[model samples]
Target: MKFTATQTGKFSGPGFTARCVLGKGGVVKASQKREGDGASPAGTWPVRNVFFRPDRLDPPVTSLPLVPLKPYDGWCDAPDHRLYNRPVSLPFSASHEKLWRDDHVYDVIVELGYNDDPVTPGLGSAIFMHLARPNFEPTEGCIALEQNDLLTLLELMVPGAEIEISF
Candidate 1:
C-alpha cells in the first residue's frame, strides 16, 4: 500500500481518506528540498521503523519494526555534525531534535526513508509522518495526520510500504 499526498494537503491510501497537514511551504521536488525548507519532498520513499511513546499509549499493532521512544532520544539535524540526518542520544553537543516532546506530536513517529541512504548534509533531516496537533498544523518538513487516522494506517500498512508524495 502507498500513502500519496497532494499539494492541497490531502492524503489517500488503500482504505482511508485521511486529512493531512503539509509543510508550511508546501511540497517540492526532491532536488529542491533543502534543510529547514519546510516543504515535503516529492517522491516515493520507503516506510522505515516506527517510534512511539509508551507512557502515553500502548504500542500500536503493526508489522513494521516498532520501538519505544526514550526521553534522551533525538534526531541530529545539525548538518555539520558527523551524525547528521541520524538518530542521536540526547544531550548531544550538536543541534538535534528532542524526541521527548510534550506536545504529543512526536508521541508516534514514522521515520520515512528520506535522505538516509547516504544522508546528504543540508538536504533535509527528520522527515517523518507523525501525530498532528488538534488543528492539524503545518509541520516543519513532515506530514502530520490525526492520531486515529494514523493508527488505522499503521495497522493496515505492511513492512516496506512506500509513501508516495507527488506534485
Candidate 2:
C-alpha cells in the first residue's frame, strides 16, 4: 500500500483522506533538502516503524512494527555527528530531537525512511508523520496530521507501505 501527502495539505490512502500540514518551508526535492531547512523532502519514503508513548496511550492498532517510546528516546540531527539521522539515547552529546515531547504531538509517531538509506550527513533527519498541533501548524520538518486521522492511516498501512510525498 502507498499513501500520499501533497503540498496542498492533503494526505490520503486507499479509502480515507485527511488534512495535513507540511514543514514550515514547504516541500522540496530530496537533493535540495538540508538540515534545519524546514521542508519535507519529496520522494516515496518507506514506513520504517511506529513509536508511541506508552505512558500516554495504549498501543495503536496497526500492522506496522511498533515500539513503545522511552523517555530517553532521541534522534540525532547534528549533521556532523556520526549518529546523524539515527536514534540515540538521551544525554547524547550530539544535537538531537527528543522523541518524548511535552506536547502531545509526539505521542504517536510514524518514522519515515528519509535520508536513512545511507545516512547522508546534512541531508536532513527525523522526518516523521506525527500528530499535528490543534490548529494544524506547520512542523519544523515533518508531516503532521490529526491524531484520529493518523491512527486511521496507520491502520490502513501495511508492513511494506510507503508514503509518497510531492510538492
Candidate 3:
C-alpha cells in the first residue's frame, strides 16, 4: 500500500494503478539473486513489527503495531545451518547466516514468510524497511523510502500490513 523508490518512466499493468504496490527508495541499487545487484526481491513478507523515532510521539505507532525487542527475536537466512529456515539467537557463527543485526536498519522489519520453505533458503535474507538514499533509487532486496514517509505510514498501517511483490 506504500511506495518508497518509484521509477520515473510509465509503469504499466499492475504498476500502472495507484493501488498496485510500488517501490521508491534505493531503486537503482535494487537487486535480485542473479543480477548480482540492483534488483528488488520478489515475494510476500508479513510485517513483523513497527519501530518509531523515539523523539516523535504525536503521529503515534498505529499500523502493524509495535513489538518490543526480545532476546530470541530473529529471522534465519543461513543456508548451511540446521536452523536454515527458522529464527536463531546471537553468538552464532555460520557460512550463510544473516541474523538481524543490531543496527537501525533492522529496527523496523517485516518478517518475510517465503524463506520458511523447506526446499530452499527462500532467496536472500535481512530484508526490511530501511532509510532510502537521497536520490531515491533501488534497494538491495528491501523496500526503502524517506524516513518521514515511513513514519507517517507506520502510524496509519493496520495490524496485518502485508507486502506482496510480483514480477
Candidate 4:
C-alpha cells in the first residue's frame, strides 16, 4: 500500500490514517527542493530501507530491509564530496547529519528515497519518516509521526511501498 500525505498533517494508508508533521518550510515540488530549504519534496518516494536505534527499542515489524543505526552512522550532505547524500562515519570531515541522534526522533527511521539515486548536488538529502514531537512539530524535511503511528505504518508497509506527498 502507498502512504499519502496532505498539507494538513493527515497521512493515510490503505487501511489507516495517522497524523503526521511535515517539514517546517512545508511541501514543495521536487524541483524546488534545495539543500537546507526545510521543505518536504512533493513526489512519490519509495521506501529505501529502515534504520533503528536497537539500543532503544526492538526491531520494527516490517518486510523492508532493516539496519541498526550505528553510533558512527551519519549522512554526508556536503555537495562537493563524493559521498554526498550517502551514509558516512561520524567525525566526518564534510558536512553531515548524524543518524545516531540523542533524541527519540531517529529511534525509528525509515529512509525515504529522495535525491539519492544519483545524489545530485544542491538537491535535498537525508529525508526520512521518523518519530514526531509531542506537539507534532515540523521536521527538517521529513515526515514525522508519533511512535505508535509510525509503527503502525511500518507494519502496513511492504517491500516496494512508496509514499506520495501533495500540497
Best-performing candidate as measured by TM-score: 2
Clashing pairs in 4: none
Over all chains combined, what TM-score does candidate 4 have?
0.98
The per-prediction tally of clashing pairs is 0, 0, 18, 0
- What are the per-residue Cα lDDT tens digits for candidate 1 across 66-116? 989999999999998889999999899998999999899998999999999
**What's the distance in Å from true for residue 146, model 1?**
0.4
lDDT of 2 at 30: 95
Provide TM-scores for the models.
Answer: 0.97, 0.98, 0.57, 0.98
Name the lDDT value of residue 17 in candidate 4. 96
- By TM-score, how accurate is candidate 3? 0.57
Model 2 TM-score on a 0 to 1 scale: 0.98
Off by over 4 Å in 2: none
Q: Candidate 2 residues 1-167, lDDT tens each?
A: 89999989999889989999999999999999999999999999999999999999999999999999999999999999999999999989889999999999999999999999899999999999999999998998799999999988888899999999898
Residue 88 in candidate 4 has what lDDT?
92
Stronger candidate by TM-score (2 vs 3) = 2
Q: Per-residue alpha-carbon lDDT of model 3 for 1-167, expressed as tens digits? A: 43222343222222222211234322332233422243455554566656433433333456565644444456555665677655566556653323244445444444444344432543455556555555645555566545655565565556655555555
- Candidate ranking (lDDT, best to worst): 2, 4, 1, 3
Runs of candidate 4 exceeding 4 Å displacement: none
